[model samples]
Target: KSLTSAGRTVLNLALVVISSVAAIGAINLSTRESSDSSTFLLTADVVAPTLTLSNSYERRDGIVLGEGFYNDWGHLAEIHRSTRVEASTTVDDCLYGWTKVDTYGTETFTGYGDQVEMIFESVGWNGISLLIKCPSTEQTATYPVMVKYVRREIRLLNESDRSTFFDTLYTTYTTEQVDGERAYGKKFRSIKRLVSEHLLGAADKECDHWHDDAGIMTHHIAFTLEMEQSLQSIDKTVTIPYWDYTQDAYELDDWTDSDIFNPAWFGMASPSSKDHVITEGRWAYMSVGKQADTDGVRNPYGLLRSPWNTNPTPYILRHRYVYDEKDGGWTLPGCTDFSSAWSYNSLGEYFDELNGELHGPVHIMIGGQWWVNRTMNFSATNGGDFLLASKFLWRQGYVRCPELCSDDTPDDRCTCSCPDELTRYFRTSRDFLDQTGLFNLSDGLFSDWSNFATTGCMTPDDCFDTVVKALCHVGHAGEMFTSAAPYDPTFWPIHGLADRYLSLKRIQAHENETILSQMWSYSHDGNSPSDTRRVCDWSKVGDTMGLPDCYVGDCAGHRAQDLLPMGNFLDRNESYTNEEFYKFMNPRNEELPYIYDSFTQWPACTDQAICWWNTDGAC
Candidate 1:
């Protein structure tokens, strides 16, 4: 069952009230002094059992066919994960393995390494903890894992509308056997979910996923989201990262040109999906690290998928607008005598406003290759999609908590498995956690990705935050961030942050040739007509790299006052017209946590202000 907008609003309001009451300690049901009364400060602890080599079978001959040759033969990477024997526990160890299979039945063995003990301990919110020898198999290894989230589907109107929607969307495949060679191979796949019924596609007769199962397809949307964090700790596991793709024979360099992104061959790319491209054109959305533009006059926002190599050349994103009679087609937006922001009425509009008939949720399908299929840690399609979404949230605003800072209000627990990319940023920022929460099997870093497959389909409401935090941590933004604010703390500081804005900018330029050309020039010559470089460059922007050194401790023998002068002022006390501050601090909070105290005061200021930073070019 999916939630409607009204339902979402209700849920949001209910949560706000509940959270507010909890924070102020206003709603107490206990009559006498409670024996165990402690103000709850949200915190998370991550734990993953250290994998140890119990045994391994490499290039072992296994499986058989009718002929002399072995039908299924492949090299295996096997090992066991061991945990210290505890007085209360029954199991002390876990065994696991990873295998690389070849089609021709030839096997080659690879070496395995040491076994680390799984240690479950308590940690402070502000201290740092790490798994001493976690398995990566190889450097740049990305273990495929899923981060599950809650999704809500909505049907705007009554039964008639609902019936029509289901009719067009729901379809089942049935096959009849005629000859030994097989007579028919027709499987039904619904297209109604691909294009908006209110837009140009529904009536088209050519759409394949279209059907006439009125009641079933009536759902206008399938809005899935994270409700909490979902993580797990396994005795033993395997991890394969993005760099692994380069090892594949068929993997392509660029997403658009790669087998993974190809719609026809691999069946993974869904360019026709509403969320994949700009409604104005069939241009697929591109990321920031990938954008480059050289020529000043060319389209800066153009869909850029550069050819193999160019010396010092900037390849900005570029896309083609191909109009087709087919339901899924591109059309550009424009204005003659009037001017209104193309996608929104005003800047006040949030993502919900942009998620209209023209805009759609991204659909990611993961398992096209064997590498994705064999792993229990991740679901090829759904897991990857959710993980990406989770990473985006973490990158944009989420902050990491040190294990030592347990007394303070920590945003969420850090699983030791928090993406290494993010851990680098936190370590650089000195945001280590020493002790605050207990690190058990449930809260371990390595465990989070593994929990998604089960928690996603079942305990969605409870796992949303966990999923969001985990995904956000793994993505590229973690290493890129130079700030020290959690998602909520640095809302304004990081609002319109580097990654997301660039993504939006790329989409905006997809259909506008003039804008595309301008973006191209800016990317290539560092002359963005729209001054987008300010948003793209972390060094120039107000990131952690350029911030004043506000730390004082240890061997330097410096005075604490000098390092943290006006440390009390570190707490926010601004009276902004909006809730940017609360949003900045407790970003994931449904309702902002209002902190009223002189200890939590911000210096009086009109415009957003930061200390010791100069704009390189322009804003």
Candidate 2:
């Protein structure tokens, strides 16, 4: 009674033929009997509908999470035509149903349509299914999609992304976590703890561990990653948005007028009250726990010697430039400066220029010269003496000499000139005085005006040492001026700019086929012999480097292989070596989870002919 294989195929074909004939006959009969008979019948088509994706979105690998795709309905559409067709009818015109099944296995009935948009609220693989229905049967097709995380410029973030970023940052800043069991289980890991780590690394007097060395880029890169990772723990969808100050420096006449200082952004550049506390912005009314003493020093772990009272002050202080064109002495580097900085082929020279010229300037401009109880004036003195005394002040835009102006005055409006060596003296003196409080009037270099006049320090090095030693004793500066600069929120974004520059440099170096490991060595002489120093030789890995006395960790030598001394402050079980930190300096590194948006407005490299790594001076 069983049928053979060929016979079964033949019988099925005959059955299909008979079904088609019956369907036609039923249709004809229904059409003829519709007037008097309420009952009418037609054979249902056995063929099922087919579903497929439209060509538009099929080529894309994925989309960024949190940024949902619009017009996605057009991307998923029914493409199959019915096998059963009439003179004017086809399955193409039939309505289709759409349903979305997410990664959680939750199904949602989108609607009855040939096209339906797909959206995912979470990151990773998401599934969307489409169902098409013909007269009798239905067909379903599923598409798998990927969603990823991307760090965008603060300005480019959508409303949802912006909210999430701020929310996570605020939450991390406010929440307290246990640091250690010592001192009654004292808590940490708030914004204060994060800033304290920066202070510990940068303010330590025994070692120049973080700044002014080859490790500057890598150390700060690791530091920033820690801060970002802390925020991401609360919400994995959030990424820290970078502030590209170069855009403001180039596009705006006055960089302070940038919208980044708006209330919705970082905050106003200048505080509205005398306390120097920011009153507007996402970080408005925020208070920090650390305080600087009159000596411009802070205890990395304990209560600070408060400037006003005996109690530690819990306030974030900023002395940013007032929002007026007249306050024009301090400024962010222009596009031309950035262009020149980007052209350096040697990592050492590039790091030196960037740290001194770009990074240091932002800190100075933001924190300002610390609050001085007294501002000395030599205007009442003779013109010659005034010119001599004002040389440093005038060049820094802190003072203007109207009496020295001539009919043919230069564009800067004053024609008085000082020796280039003295100018270097002033530059060194400003930085030395601001950073280290080691200067004193007893040095006899500037104890008296007559002594300054008779000092015959016309050469650069002698004048620099003499002036720096003299000024360091006289003035103390604000947060940004010292190693405790992280008390201000502006410090983060300013350092973000530094990180961005490193990313740019790494990209260019890779393009040129340069060896990254070879570029880690740098030699730097301290401002003074007593100042902290770092002279790294990449080839000499055995050489040891000193760490601060406050540091209780293992030794960190002056080589790329040594561990960063302050890595423990991030509360990680394992510390990162300089080489390990260096690997992630480039934003494009696979291990780095986030990427910076394009620096579309930054200047192009102009010194193409100069090869920085070429010792023989050959291009």
Candidate 3:
């Protein structure tokens, strides 16, 4: 309708004010909707889900290689709008963007209920990628984990690490491969071949090079390292975990109850099988390969070779038991006081104690024999057989026939009353000698007996005493008891402990400014004269004992400078001299590439006045 100018102006002003209020109201409505959208983003699939590591089982330093790390991801579901969490060891292009996913590594993600565990498997810089996704869009988080390569204590190893180790060990042991021409002749890459190589070092004879001498530490160091390399070839993460048996000896009331004998570990220490076959754990029903014949041919019994039996069956035997005399299990020395080894003025003394006290007792503990009474009748005969019986009686301390003969006659029909111990020894010795063709009637009993009798004796009484002493040495059973100890899987861990001891000794020597190379004296038997010949002096072939000159065929002799008998078992490209092994024995050595998690603790007492329990208090 037509109106005056003033009325129209007033109406226009009023209309302008109404329009401004409506515009402000529209802005407020838009802001309210935006707030509602933000709430929707919190509850729905608008923004990416937050991903984080709520908890991790890794040490503050770094993750252990092969051991792996456990991580919890429950915090990723903070928004909880159909959230998804995925983890991978490998990341293709996470640097480009969080949503960009491409490739994964060899290690599979293992976890349950918003958690993930992963093994790096290799040393050095490794990374883990986590991808978190809501209903729409995804975010990624990468963690740089440094993995350490080291040999750890068996008891301390996690389930995954232990599994990896055993898996690699069993694979390496079982996987057979023929070797090309190298040291100690060509052979297969199997435990059988390892046993054969060890057998060559001694061959069930008194005269030997590798054992009970200064060379023992160096030789076994090389042997065990070679074995470790073989296992590493399969799984790069695996290191031979040392079983600190001293822990068992000192910590436990019954060492047999150690977790090392659990099914997940080395298995049953005492098997229930009549054949002594291990029937539980990872190595259950394992075959030891074919037993070699008398002529060293791989024929006859498809089992481990044993001097106790001519036709040994296919089985790995263990006779672990407590020696009644000790009241406890076998006492493993160097529990708290490694002074027994480190206190020695010379390396010779240290090695002597190591071999006799530490090494030999373990073998006996694992493979010692039980005495049992048995009655048997023997029909007397003349000629070589009669001479054999008489020789046996003489060796057993029955100097005259009257001492042995129950009928009180030195005739062919004379009956002998033999002690069970002596009888068992005689039978085992005779059978072993006969089977191995070491001694027989054809060799002329008088001459062979004379050589054997004079080899380790000064007189007839000395000879008889030597025979009695030899009984304790040879009364053991099973593969570990013999020179062919590598046949038993337990041999590796025991030797690993020995290696650890070697490392400790090396460190102690270094601290004292005494090099192992400086101390050079070969004392196999305490009675035997010290053989001061250097290993480089190949002219000296025989051992300290004046026994037959049967030395290790490949190596020179027992000295720090001697070339280790690597044989075909070790890599030919590598130079494994005794000195090289001596250097490798140091855990801190750069070339060693690995270190132990911990070492056997030394005694707290630094001086006589400082008692262990009261070092910080009044004496």
Worst 10 residues of 3 by lDDT: 72-81
Q: Give the TM-score of candidate 1.
A: 0.18
Tens-digit per-residue lDDT, 1-619, candidate 3: 2122322332232333223422321011110123223322433322122232221212422432222211111111111011133332322221112221111223244333233433444332233343433322334344333233466667667788789888877865676545312222232245666666666664432234676577877777667766766666666556787776766666677666778889778787767676567888888887777544344312123344433222244567776532122211345543444444544566677677666666666665565332211121111111112222222332222222121222233233322223443335444444434432223332333213343343345564443333333322222245665556787777887766666666655654556534454455544442211121212222342423121333222234466677776733223355666666666565644334455544432222233232222214233
Which TM-score value belongs to model 3?
A: 0.54
The alpha-carbon RMSD values of the candidates against the true structure, listed in the order shown, are 32.0, 16.8, 20.4
Which runs of model 1 end up more than 4 angstroms from their true locations? 1-292, 295-358, 362-374, 377-537, 541-619
Which ranges of candidate 2 are over 4 A from the true structure? 1-148, 179-188, 279-285, 290-313, 321-330, 373-476, 513-518, 523-558, 565-575, 599-619
Worst 10 residues of 2 by lDDT: 78-87
- Candidate 2, residues 1-619, lDDT tens digits: the string is 2112322332332333333422331111111122322232325542322233322212232332222221221121211111111112225644455555443455777666544444444332333444444434444444433232344557666677677777766765566545321311322145656665666565433344676666777776666666666665666556667666666665678666887777766677656566667777777767655433333334322333111111122455555532111121446765556656655666676666656666666765565432221222211111111112222232232222222223243323322223343335445553443422223312322333343332355554554455433232222233565555655656665666666666655654655634333367654533322122422222332222221123222224335887875454223354777877667455444324444544322321213333332333234
Segments of candidate 3 deviating more than 4 angstroms:
1-148, 178-188, 204-206, 291-303, 306-311, 321-329, 334-337, 370-476, 512-517, 523-557, 567-572, 600-619
Each prediction's TM-score versus the true structure: 0.18, 0.55, 0.54
* Per-residue lDDT value at 181 in model 3: 20
